[model samples]
Target: VGRYLVQLPRGALSAHDDALRRAGIRVRRGGAVLGAGGKASLGPLSPARRKPPSSSPRLDAITLQEQLERALRERQARPTGICPVREALHGALLEELAGTIARDEPRRGTLLRRVAGEARMTIDAYRTVYEKSLLFGASKLSEAAALKGNLEGRIAELQAETASLADEVRSLTDLCESLEHRAQRAEAQAEAETHDASALRAEGEQLQGLLDALRPG
Candidate 1:
């Protein structure tokens, strides 16, 4: 029963199998199902994946066959223009798996190449968008840096101006002290003049009394 189940259609896989089934050709092959470079559920790595450079997983016959089948499916479904562009570029990266796949599945190099080509175009389109985004970001960063420099310059100017104002304040304080000293001297001089005038009046009054006494004698 297990053997029969294993031999049953592994679930709609290939066009050839579909044609065969239509023609009453019943065959069931055991292995991973193939689709684009994604979905471990389908047993194909996500078509858009980040793998270490120079990293390729070892492939067995079953695995290679499944990978090839997936590439074929993805090729047929290639879009006219991969939208958002970034995902397209990612597809290109995953397409490198074709090279790894060919090492083990050399029998299907032609199919792998087709998959790689489609991924390449998608990636190329994405690269254009990626490059534009980088340029725009760099321009914005430059503007921010320039603004920062200007702010620093303004701060320096304000600090220098503040120092100059402080110096002016000190000078004004000294001038005020000098003016107060001069005012104190003027007040002292005025008091001395008043005392001298009173002394002169007293001396004149004593002289008048002496004159009257001499007249009476």
Candidate 2:
């Protein structure tokens, strides 16, 4: 919806005007655009009044009344080459707008008061709504923290168990090395004893032979 100076036949224009207004469009007529005795239509503005480019957070923070005041002040502050008749028409247009706003102020105030009363009636319920949202968010955070703590505890237990298993493995490794050393020593001793026994048997046979020779040769 926008402010438009669209031209149509008297009948079509009236119907179109009603429709546009219902849809929140500001339809400007030629006479209504300048002043009460202005023409049936005015020339289209250089740039159409479409939605303005998206504003920043700082601009969005400006209230509607403030924006309106700033726009009025800017227009008044600027120097223009408007002809005398056009300037007069512009002044008349401003006067008419002021009168219209003055007339509507009471109705607007009544609507505002009614709305404020309704809001007051529901304020407690709205408070509960916000409280519930906070409670849910806090609960989720609490659960996440608990889960994180449990995971950390489990990791610590696993690390401790792994360290204990590693020590047991080291002890087993040392026992195996000792057993291997003992087996090797026993094998060497058995080989040496067998060699000594063979030498002793051979000496005893030679001594027997000598005794036979000395007894009855």
Candidate 3:
């Protein structure tokens, strides 16, 4: 047989004793004694509980943002020019700096506390510099576009001139061909006239021979 001791809230003690009696278990109210050879145990009426581990770190978004802002501010304080390419370089630099800050060796909170203010200021400064640089780059690109357009217009004009020249050459070639054909026709006409003249001369000589024979010489 097993023996057990149970502790209960004063209000629940009477109810517990009644239930134990109904179950044929011996009931003793406060300060009960256990008999020899009776095994005893305690506890089973409360809900199980758990607590979160104390070692885990908490994330602080505000501190991290502040740190980033400070780093950006420092970068902004550095002298920079307003060119598109330069602005792009500055943006890249800021991004790299942000990444380094995010991957700092110390705890995130400690690193943030150390650098947050400066990073914020640097970010603002970099923003202005980058914007200006972008504007300058856009202007330069616009100028380059205009220059390209002008060059294209000139090329088009040259092409048109070349086409005109080609057309003139074609016309000249046609005229030359016509002139050669006319020259050939003229030469053929001249040869025919010369043959007729030779035939007329032979006939005149034959007539003269007949006249001489008639004149009895």
Candidate 4:
């Protein structure tokens, strides 16, 4: 009379209970079942099941495995000219592997290994394609690292060039300011000289008028 608590869907529980009864194992369907010593045999079951409501949502383990394999095969079947899609597939595979590795489930390592094997197979098949399109013989990760390094270097060079150009602009701006200041001073001096010349001409006109008056009288 060993009691085993099985948590499953209502339908699944009914099926299991029927099966256990057929095997001569005692099973009771209620809120909680206790063991032989009157200790609680089963923990509290959440009313909500972990799985989706749909009985057949096409997310079975076999279907998922098949889909993953099919995707890998399709990617392998592509022509070498289709490098972008191949690279995209490779990236997707890598990301899936990372996600699988991050999962806390006991089967996470197994899933990751399966995905890694599939990715490796696809990568082997697309090696030639990558060499042709990516123009490098290295693996995708290596190529990515190299591309990143090259971009960083180019960015640094561009930044340095931008700084130099900014300095040049600042120098030009300062020079323009100095020229403007000198121009303002020259304009003020010219205005003062014109005023002095006008005063001298007026005095000479007055002297000439006096000399003419004295001569005529």
TM-score of each model, paired residue for residue = 0.41, 0.39, 0.43, 0.38
Candidate with the greatest lDDT versus the true structure: 4
Cα lDDT of model 4 by residue, 1-217, tens digit: 2223456555555545545556665443345443433333543233221222234435444665676568767767465555556566656656544554455453775777777779777876777676676655456778789999999999999999999999999999999999999999999999999999999999999999989989955
Residue 18 lDDT in candidate 3? 47
TM-score of 4: 0.38
Alpha-carbon lDDT of model 4: 0.64
Off by over 4 Å in 3: 1-53, 58-133
Expressed as tens digits, the lDDT of each residue in 1-217 for candidate 3 is 3333455665564455545555666533333422232333322212111111133223334544565557557556444544444444445445444444455444653555456557657866988888889999999999999999999999999999999999999999999999999999999999999999999999999999999989964
Tell me the tens digit of each residue's lDDT in model 1 across 37-147: 321232244423322233233443456557655755665544454444435444554465565566568757558788667867787878789889889999999999999
Compared to the true structure, candidate 2 yields what TM-score?
A: 0.39
Model 1 residue pairs with clashes: 35-70, 37-45, 37-46, 37-47, 38-45, 38-46, 38-47
Give the CA lDDT, 0 to 100, for residue 168 in model 1.
100
As for candidate 4, its clashing pairs are none
Off by over 4 Å in 1: 1-133, 215-217
Q: How many residue pairs clash in each candidate at the backbone level?
A: 7, 2, 18, 0
In angstroms, the error of model 3 at 151 is: 2.4
- RMSD of candidates 1 onward, in order: 14.5, 17.9, 18.8, 18.6
lDDT of each: 0.63, 0.60, 0.61, 0.64
